[model samples]
Every structure is written in C-alpha cells, then in structure tokens.
Target: MRFARAIALGAVTAVTGGLLAAVPAAAQATGAPAASAAATVSVTLTGKAVRADGRAVDEVGVFVVPAARWVDEDAAPVSTALVADNGRYSVTASVAAGSSLYVRVDDWTSSDGYMDRLFVGKGGKAAFTYVGLAPIAAKAGTIELGTATAPKLSTVRVTTSAPVHCAKLLRKNGTLAAMECDYTVDKKVFTFTGMYPGEYTVGAMWSSWTDARATVDVSAKKGVTTAAMLTLESPTTMTGVVQDTQGKALEGIAVWANGPDSPRTVTDATGRYAFKGLTAGSYVVDYSGASGMSSAYRDYVTRTSTVSVTSGRVTTAGSTLTKGAQVTGSVTPLAKETYGTIVALAADGHVLASDSYWSSDGKKRDFALHGLPTGTHTVVVQDAASGRYAKSTVVVSGTSARTVGALKPAAAPVTVRGTVEGTTAGFVSLRYGTSPLYRGAIDGGDVKPDGSYAITHVVPGIYALRSHRTTSTAGYEGNLLSVTVGDGVAVRRIPQPTRKVQTLQTLVRTSVTFDGRALPGVVPLPRRTPADLWGNWTNEKGVGQAPWTGRAWDAVVLEDVFFAYHSPYYFVVKSPTSVTKPGDLANVTVARVAGGPTV
Candidate 1:
C-alpha cells in the first residue's frame, strides 16, 4: 500500500494575515511561509530530516496531521512541506488551541524505499518540546523538533484463521492505525506497511466469529516484516427455556439476551430459545413477554440461575416466570399544579415504567403501574410545574395490586448556606438525586471572599454540594458532601482540598556582591550553592542595572509564592552583587522579608 502521496491543500482553510502577529519570529524563517495567526492556534514545527546515519535528506515530504484523525483513511495534513537539501524544514499549521497534531516525515519515492518516521519529540519522550507529545497541544508558537531520523520502515503482516472483515493496529502509546484486509487474497491476511518500529497490537474482526487480538514488535530496519497471528475463536452461544412456575412449557415467551448486540428471540413450542454468534462473556437472560408471568433475569449458570457463554460452547439458563404484581398510588398536589408524573424504579435505579395523572381540580390523582416482578421498587410522584416530588418504596409480590397511600409532594424549596474553605473564587452548585426529579442547580451562588456561599430555592432531597475553584489549575474538588435539604435553612462547612507547592524557577541577570550582610527585618535565606539558587519565585522589581564585562552574570534568586502558575520566573530583585560569572557567586545568598508575599 502507498504510504505517502500528494494531498490537496484545499481542505486547509487559509489563515488571515492579521493573525500573524502572534506567530513567533522563528516561524518566519526562509524556505517557509511567514507564520500567521488567527482565531485558531498555530503550531510552527521546525526540524531537520536526516537518515539513520545522520546524513541530510532531500525531497522528504513532511506533514503535520491532526492526531485525532490520524487513523482515518482519507485524513489530509493541515500543513505540508518538503525537506530542504540542508535537511532543515519548517511547516506551520493553524489548528485549534490545545489540539494534538502528529508530525510525519516520509519519502516513499526515494530509492531508499519507504523510509519514514513519526516525530515523537526529542529523546523519544512525550514531553512538550514547544508542542506536547502525541496529541501535540496546539500552542500558538514554534515547536523546535531538533531532528527527525528516518530509519528504514518496517511492516507488520497480520494473519487470522477466519476471513478477516477489518483490522486495526494500536501502538503502545494508544495511537490507532487502521489496516485494510486483503480480501483479494485469502481474506485472512492484513498487511500494514511503513510502520514505525515499536510494539503494536493487531486486532482482526470476523463477521460471524469472535474477533482476535495479538501483540507484535516491528524491527527497526527495512525488509523486515513482523508476523502476527490472530486465531479467531468460535462465537459463543446461549440457549434457554422459559416455563411457568408449574413446570409447564411457556411457548412464545420472548427470551432476551441482554449482552452484546442484545439478541432476542421467542421460545419455541418446547419453550427453548437459542442465541448464537455472541462474544464470550456473562449474559443477563431476561424473559418478560409471557402473559401474566413475572419478568426474570438469569445471571449465572447452574444453581446460580445465570448464564455465561464460552467460545464454541453453549451455556444453558432456564427461567421460571411467576405471576407479576401491580402497583397503585395517588399523588396529592401540594400546590396549584393539576398534573404529575409517576415513575416506578427498580432497586437498581432503572426506571421500570412511567405513567402520568391529570386532574381538573387541585386534588389527588391516581396512577397504576402493572407487570412489576417480585422485587422492591421505589415509586415516585412529581409535580410537573412546581418541581415538587415524593417517593416511597413498595414490595411487589403475587398477583394483587399493591396500593400505596396518597403521597404529598414536598412544599417550597429551602435555602442552603455553607462555608467553602480553601478557595474563595468559585461557584457552589447542587447535584440532586432522582427522588427530587430535578438534577441541576435550582439556584447556584458564588463563594464570597469570606469563603461563605448560599444557594437559594433548593428542592428538598439528597444532594451533592459540589464546589470548584476558578483561581488556578491546582484547584481540586472537595470531598463530596452529601446533604439532605428540608424545608428549613441548611448550613455546613466544606473544606477544600489542599494546594500542593509547585517549584518554579527563572533566569535572572543581575550583579552580585560578596558583602557578608543580610537585609534588615528579613530572615536568612536558605543556604545553598550557586547551582541550587533556582527555586520558586513570584515577582521581580528591578532596583538597578550596570554593565559588567566578562561573561554576563545571570543570578537565580528562588522565592516561594502562591500566585505563580504559568511563566518561569516569579520573583526578582537587584542586589549589590558584582560578579562576572555564575561561579563567582558561590558564597552569595538571598533573603526574604518575614511574612512577605515571596517567602
């Protein structure tokens, strides 16, 4: 298969010149178009195309493909460029901010034969070298990819026992590459050429058989084809019989295999139902359509009454349907609402069925839910307009209609107040449970500077008081505080998660003096060698500047602060240290004011 071919540039929208102001000067270098910026972020990739032996390569087609669409067959590059004879190339692509992009360098037409490499950044680390790893975060700047070494490409020959419908190759780093099955041949082979040297997982799918997956490693040389064999397993099967509690066969009962594909069928005259072509796994066999019979589920094999099918084997699960019960309830309108919705939920919180009631006068309306299996269910009644709701648990058994007395919906919502510790700048909302039938924030409030927040008009129910900090990225969620709100005012103190210290450093160019004195009212700074002077800093106020001959002295003064998130340097100050080189400041140390912003 052809790996690299000409791609049309029409798909890439042209960036406006006004957006070029944000492009770095390095992107405007010769042999490449001047970088332009617009509403979308732009990444300027600069790299050298070299052979494995480090020789400059010419005529190499370098492209930046969006990582999200890399597996697509017709995915086009956002930007493409050819390697200069000097091996250096630069390509700029306008992409969405924070988006990831893949850098691919290829020259399949060369006499060297399909030599290619995918740029994973320097030292093969996923770290951001201007742009981050695999999904290179689309930062609007230049990404200095020092060199891209095109080692001889390798191939992966994937084979399977059954006719493969499709296949996919997954890299160890979670990069997916689609592979085409060789249908013209035996249909069992999927050859992926021009693969980078690494560990890859090969997956093959068959129409009526269980799919297969195998891991293989492709070598780092040309003419080497890694062989991977995926032996397809036979599809699993589940057969069952549905009968009445009296041991009589129940014909025409729908037995549903609630597993992959959710295959369903009706029982024959013998009360036997079979479901084939299923993957090996646990299955929840359910039968519900029998007249007046209770719905049931078989989750295990043998005495457990459930089913789990294995490859080429059959698992049997027979269910005996009993008489189902019914539930009847009346919802009393707490306010002026005339209609309400009634829902019956299983113990697992799945809605069994829903029914509505309407009344011309503001009086109680009746509702009925039938065909409930022998189990515990929570019946809920909700006012359509006022958002008031009430729920009660009912036990359903036998054929009688269980009557739940009238349920009065809750009255007006309540006011909730709390002290939000740790962060003082975010919003506080409530995630209500289903009993209230309202999930969103009826009313959310911003945390005051004093760390107090109040949410008004909150419905009465169990809720999770969620807090967020908009101050910094280090902001984390406090432990979920489950609160039960009633008609009165509720108050609680929620402590936010602690903030971790992030070490930040920046190079500060200044003169250092060897005066054995410390600034007044300031504590002695941490003693360390000049090499270890770089630490966390918050701000810099230049005091003075003087020209020093010799090697320009760049002194690093480390300070700890709470406001620094982005940027390398935080705090800077000018002192009377006159040193030619960084080594001259071996005895120099700095001090910080007591209780100052920079500790």
Candidate 2:
C-alpha cells in the first residue's frame, strides 16, 4: 500500500462548492444540477471499523465501491470516508436512483503486527463485510454497513462458573501486551479479542460466591479459536518469614510462588512474604537461600506437606530459609567497543544469580554472582552488543567464588534469517555457548513486524537459536535449536510450541513449623489510627507501612481503636477438607526441611 493521510483541502472545497468540481458544470446543468432535486439522489454510507478484540480502529480509509456499473462506466467508488476513534465513518455520494455500491475499507497501516499494509475489501478474507446499496425513492438515503473487524488476532472466549470480574487474559510469556482485560462483571463468559494463537492464562478477581480466582491455562491451537471452561473454587492466602541461621531477618529476599501461577514478590523490611488472591492449592515458596562460596558452612532446609488453603480465610505457609554460602565475582570485558555484558551463574539453565555490566564512559565491567547454588555452575559472560564473550565452569564449596580473569573473543560474523511466528513480540538470539543454566549469547536482534528476523555480522559457527518473549518463557515451541551458519545468511523456522503447562492445583496452604512456632508470613505494620483502616488512606501519614510495599493485608478493623502492630497473622492450613481440628490430618506426611541434595 498506498496510504493517503488526508484529502487535499482545495479538492474537498471544490467538490462541496459546486457541480463543476464533482462533474462538468454543463453536464450537471443539463442532466443533474449539483445540490438540486435531480442530484438529491444521494446515499449515505456509514459503519464502525474495529479490531478483532472489539476495540475501535481509527484512521482506516472507507470507500463506496460501485456494485452495479452505470452507462459505459465500470463499477468504482463514488465517495470515501475515514474511520474515527469511535470507529464510525460517514460518506455521502451522488448517484442515479438505481445506482448501487459496496462499502469497502481502503488501505491503511495496521498496528496489530501485520507486516504489510492492510488490503481489506471484498473476498480478501477480511473479517468485515461490504454492504450493498439499494435504490432510494426518498431524497435522503442511508445504508448502514454495521461493524467491520480487522483480521489480525484470534479471539479466545473464557466461560466460567461465575462471572469473572476484572479478568485479563495473559499471553504465554505472562505479559499484558498480547491481550489485556475483556472484563465481564456479571457475564459468565468473557471474550478476549486481539489474541494471537498461542498459550494463555485466564484469571479473574475476587468473587463473592466461590473463593478461587478461577485461573486456568488455555492451550490455544494455531489458527484455532480457544473456548475454555473453568470453575471457581475456594480462595486463600499464603504467608511466611525467611531468616538467617542466626535468626536475623533477611529483607529484600526474593520469594517465588511455584505453582499454577508463578507470581513473585520480594520480602518486606521484616523479612516476611505474603501471597494473596490464590485459589486453594498446593504450593511451594522457594526462597533465596544459602549457596555459592559460603564461608565453609553446612546447609539445611526446614519442615513442610499437601498444604491446604481454605476459602474466605488466610492460610499460612511459613518457611524458614537458613542462609546459604555466598558466592561473589566480577567481569572484565575484553573490549570497550561493545554495548554491555550480562554475567550469570547458571545451573541447569536456571540463573541462580545474575547481573548486567554496562560500559560507562570511562569504567570497566564489574559483575558479581552471589549465593550461587552449591556444586558447579557455568559463569557465562558475553558482550551485549557484539555477542562476543567467554565462559568457564567452577565448583563451589561452602560459601565460595572464583575470578574469571579475562574474556574470550567472539567468533566470526554470519547472517541468520528466519520467520518467527508467535504472539510474543520477542527476539531471535544467536547464542554460542549453552549450559543447563543459561544460554550465552553470541548476537541477537528483534524479529520484524513481518514475522521475519535477520542477525547480520553474527560469528560463523554452530550456535543455538533461542526465541524469547518479554517474559522468561521462550515463546518458541521446541527445545533449544542448533544451527550451523557460514559467513552468509542461514534460514530456519523456529516453531513455537503450543504446549499447555500444568499449574499446581490449589490445595489447602501448608507451612513448615518446628518447635511449635508457625512461620510468620504476613508481616503487618502497626495500626496507628482509625483513618488507616476505614478511609482517607495516605502514604505519608506514618500509617506504619512506609517502608513496606506490596503487602497484602488480611483485614483491618476500626473497632474500639485501630492500632498498627508489627507482625502479620500467620495461619497455616494443615488440611482443608479433612481437618476440623489440628489432630484430624496426621495421615498427610511431612518432610523435614534439611539440606537438600546439591544439584
């Protein structure tokens, strides 16, 4: 395409000015005079143009294509209009009483990641339909063409037992860029338009009837519409506190919810972690514990179960994470003529500790990997811009680390080109080195809008192809790809799998407890006044929650007097359905949190 931003002012003025502008004055004066009774045979074409997701599409060009030929003239457009933000457009054209036309959308750029400019007309597989104009005996005529939808994304409908409130359909990479909320308050089914065919997760907010958030994975097939069915269940909360072997709080530690939903958050100043709005399910709170070059000390984990969280209640899954060995190191790039460096200590392709070192105007690279898991790990380092780097493997004893003195040079340049088809706006990476922990990059760049990408000047060698969305998950379907490229372009199709990853089912939340003390999960600030809980919430009024952020409060009361305390309520769900009291669930065994075997 041809994209014309706006019609010229003079042409528009003349067309509206007199008959000489639209047609010859002598012909109009003889046959049909402009703005006269004979020329009053006009047709108004109007409609709303939209994207697949039901969002209004603006700046689309609309045309009235002639459906029936006139005397010696071919079928063609008699008028045009531009779609507005509300997706509405109106065009008035003068024609004979029996003249007919089809409403067609003209060429325009689509923001929905289509490579080519849009060509949506009759029989183009467009999601829109052209309306046929009929003869009008009245002076005024109107032809309502209804709605025109763009043919970009596939629509996925989520049918739930309860109406999903404030629900959003998340993409495979767990980002909102693919499709946000097609919220339904009381409707049982929610339709999410503007979705590319891929795996997705659908979740709803707090519901009055059932406790669970009704989160489910939709394994959308390629070119197939996904209609998912999910039921609501009881909802619950999980909380815990992590501390060092010396009983000191380890604030700012990363606590991950390893289950159906992998939502992660950091500990507060009190070393307490809280996970709210989760369906009752089995879950593990993996804390950042002792590892790497520790000061030659032994490590151990605590006790834990088939933890159950009850509906309309908070379940405490407290965990005591004893600090592990600390590993630290630095990176010194070989050359300064590059972008930056990403140094990671990876074990089994999972990054234990990672940090980036960008080139300053006059500084050298310094990267450190702290608390690397015990045993051996690959220290992968590469230039961010040029993809040149080095790697080495080292074994970590009790808290320990080693210096990877100098970096290695990158390989020769090669061109790797391929079509990357997925909803993820991800990039294709040409990586040279790989460990179970991480893939060391050689060079990488973004995939274009046309589903194609080319990494020029890549070092010619055998490299692993990794396509990744914004999230940690690689959007591509298959395993790590291996390709051999010479000095020129190498073509490959990286198939993105539509595999449905199973999330841990919701069970009663459980926490490991020893010595009769439950682990403290929800750390609450002191309740100072009535305004803190009731209303007039202010961030600066010393609500006792200044330093702590991202905390999920169980409940606040304005009863006699609201006094903020320091500790959150810790409730551990020993069992959900079987346990009325603490003694009813002795059958569900427990594992002592001891030193886990080093990988």
Candidate 3:
C-alpha cells in the first residue's frame, strides 16, 4: 500500500522537478498529481471569500499549499498568508506558473461560525482542483483567485413510520451531531437544520422499537436539502424469561447484546427479558448475576447465547443459569490510523470484529468478553502493536454511541522537545517508553512555528522522536534521544533525524519503542499547560493530537464555548436582545477572528 506522494523540492518548473508520465503510487482521496509545466513563471493569486448572501470573509487562512494536498491530504503548504481586511488576498507563490496547483483555506472561520476542514474552489468539476483554475504569468499579481462562497447548512429530514419518537443525528464518524432532537409526531419526520456538509446517520428510537438502521446513509452538501424515508415494515420483538434450575424466575439480571450497536436491558420481576427494534442478525447475549436463583440453581454459570434476528422478525435464545457472576462490555476506537490496531481487554479479549464486530463509522474496532466469572472486571484497553498507546483504559461507561468512550493512552507527564524541520508551525509531540506507551510533548509555546522547540521538567530516560517531515522539508525521523537529569541540570536540544511522512506510520508502529523500565502509557504535559486546537471540535474520544493552533501546544480536552446544534452561530448582530430569529439577523454583524472580515 504505497501512497502516491509529490515531493515539491526547491521551487522548480513542475511540482516534483518534473511530472512523471505515470505515477507508481496510488492517488489519494484529496486530488490527483500535478502535471508538468515550465518553472519560468511564478503566480500571484488575488481573491476574496464571501457568503452565499454576498458578505465578505476576512482574516481566514489564505495560502498556497501543495496542489497535491487537496488529494494527498497529509501534504502541507509551501507558502501561507491570510485574507486581508478588505476581503482581498494577494500571494506570489513559487509554482511552475503554468502547472496546476491548489489555492484555498485549510480550516475556515466565517460569519456563521467555524468549520474545521473547509475547502473553497470546489465548485466546478475539473475533478479535485478545488474547482480547477486558469494559469498565470511569471510573477503574476492580483490574478483574481475568485470568490469562495461560504457553504450554508443543509436540512436533513428523516421520515420514519408512525410516530417514531426520539431521533438523533450523528456524524458518520460515529460521534453525535445533534442531541435531543426535535421531531414532528404528526408527520413522523425528524428534521435537523444548520448542518454542515458531511455524512450522517440516524441513531434513534422508533415507535416501541429501537433500530440500528432506522435511516439510510444521507449526505449533506452545503446549500442543499435531502430527505430519507425509512419504511418500517413489520417491527420485530424478542421476548423470553430467564429461570433457575428450580424454574424460579430470575429477576434483576442484566442481559446485554455482545455488539455495542444492540440494546441492553434488565429482566423484569417475572424474569422476562425482551429486545425490540431488531433486524435479522446474529447476536451474542451474556448475563450478569444469576448465581443465586435458588439453592438448586446456585452452582450454574450462564454461557453466552447466540440469537439471530431478521428484519421485522424476532428470535429468542434465553437460558437457565446456575450460580455465577461475570462482567463484559464493548470498546469503540476513534481514528483512521486506528485500523489493524489490536486492543487489549483486561478480562480476556482484543478488538476482533469477527468476534467483537467492527462499527459502521468507518472500519469498526469493537471487542467484548464473556467467561469472566471471577476477577476485577477492569475496562483496560491495550493497543495491538499498531496503536499510539501501548495500553488504554475504558474510563467512562454507557453503551449508547455518544455516551460510550474508551481506548485512550494512559497519560505520561514528562517533558521533551526537538526541532524536526525548523519549519512550519509546531504541532508536534514526543512519545516514549515502551508498551503501555507514554505520549508527551514540549509546550506549544516553547516550540516556535519555525520548528525550534524546547522541553522542560524531563524525567531522565531514553525516548524516541516521531515526526512526518523530512530534513528537506524540515522534519525529523524516528530515533532515540536520551535525557539524563542530575539534581540540577539544564535542558539541552536533542539532535533530530530526517523526517519521512511516507514512513510515519511505520515509525509509529515499528521503528519507535519505549525505554520499557518505566510506567506504561502516554506522559502528560507540564501542569497548567494550555495548548491549541485550530477550530471547532465535536466530542472527540481519547486525549490525542490536534491541528496546529499557531500557538502554545495543548492537552487532550480544552475549555471553549459550545452551542447546541439548533443554536445560531453569530458573527455580529444588532443587539443580543434584539435578535432572536433569522429575520432579526438581517442587520447584525460580528467581529471576525484576527480582525478577519472586511467591514
């Protein structure tokens, strides 16, 4: 699986010195490779960004990164700047003036609000040119980069059968998008407006039934409206009673579905348990607390039962239990690099889909355990030699998608730093020790955008430097850096190696190893540490890396103002008390970030 990468060496005629007739690597989702062109020219793109309603955008991140980054996402920019106060942008980037390149914003902060990864110039179809552009002169100036119209929210209306109450909108990434949604009982429609462009699914309850597939896959394009109708055929329900050897009904026993997607509930006083809103599928149900049904049933340990459910149908697989108490649960991992990653469940299991089912967000990383009749049922999560953490613990609980959180690296608090490329912003980290790995970093404030960084409060030990940029691009490679702190010692700059983005994963998974003799997990930053996150954040799982904030480094979760999905994101308004609806917004204005917008 070699990824097609464009090496933009010292400004040349074409992106990679010259364009190759055939690319040996596979093109990524961002866009295609740049074609060849003469280096005899330079380009200066001038433009302004505005909303669909003709309002100017200012101070947004306006730059010329690699034209290939649009396709090969990990690629960083070569030249950068901000849109001016008057909504005008001028940048003379070093590109083969005639070659194809991309000019856009990586993250956007506009009048309505902020979008983490927004792209302008994606209008016309030249494929992935961000809406391809025309070539310019050898140093062309103010060539009208064109206006990027801010994307408006999409209204997705989900129609279900009858008065199916309670519908939720979740990001395709498996995170909740809208909570406690409002629905129209008469029309059986759950409508959510003010949505950004992305994929979403409906995770909600139907009338008297709960369904995993209550809605089809719905995509929202900016300024577009979409509707998905989920026809509830024959709704299905599975009901059965749990009993002891004496046939006495077992009460208060918890029956849980092995897959995190399924629902769980307690048996009734009559020892009866039921599951509703089920589609035809194989399910594993395990019980907790049944060792005491009666003297005759006291020695029985319940085995996991296999039940198959079909669309609009029910299947029951209940069992009688002797005396036994056990614990089990599901683990959900949250990143792309999270695939092939094995997770260690303390009792006796790892994240294997065939047994532990993968989730729908992307490639699912789900796992559960049965058989644990005795022992502390600690929900600890360990990585499969491929994840960032050597081991993580499931700290929070709740089986529902939004409520459940797990598989995060344990925190390590030592400090360390180095200059990988002495270039770009310092959005870097340092991970050390071995399994139960420790991830720590130098303060973002200590690391300059030029890449010069420093780490204080170091725990004397050996560590590894992991980065994605090359020396050519000003990044470091994975290698060992030893720190020895005497009673009173000054910190020194650790030497860096070459950075290879292509091999970053390999370094992350293979090349790097911890000193091992210490505690197993990620180290934390110095206390009172304030880091940076580029834009808005949804409820992300696990403390992890974030986009560079052009400022001091940050921790996993930071403090910020959050609003509800239905709440308006204001830029400027007539008066706080004067505006309440869309009509009231007609005359208000907002103060942009960094004096960003042109008044």
lDDT of 3 by residue, 1-599 (tens): 01121211111111122111111123212232343544445566666655556545543332343332222222454556766655566656665443444454433443243332233332211111221122222233445656655545567777776445566675432334564433323236777666654556665664333533455566665556778666654556566888776898887666766442366666767888776666556677765443223333322344467777776776766777654332233444444444322222323231111122333463435454322333332333333322223233333222211112444433233345456544544343443332112223322223466666655533333334344334321334444444433333334454334444221110011010011111111111211222221222211111222222122322221211221232211111112223122232122121111101110
Against the unseen true structure, what C-alpha lDDT does each candidate score?
Answer: 0.50, 0.43, 0.39
Q: List model 1 lDDT by residue over 241-324, tens digit each.
A: 777668888666766555444565667667776665577777666565532122332111111134688877877778876656
Candidate 2, residues 1-599, lDDT tens digits: the string is: 11211110000001122111222223211222222234446767667766545656554433332221111111234566667777787777776543323444543454342211122322222321121112122235776656666545346677877544445564322222232233222456666553433446676654322224456877544224679877766446667776676777666565655554445665666767666566656665556532221222123221222346664577765556543344345556555554544444434343455566766542465655655556776665656666565667777665554665544535444578887767345677766534322334556767677777788765444567766554332223335677876666799888653443321111122322211222121112213221222222211111211111122223321111110110010111222222333223222211111110100
Work out the TM-score per prediction. Answer: 0.34, 0.35, 0.35
lDDT score for residue 291 of model 3: 26
Better of 2 and 3 by lDDT: 2
RMSD of each: 19.1, 25.8, 24.0
TM-score of 2: 0.35
Question: How many clashes show up in model 3?
Answer: 49
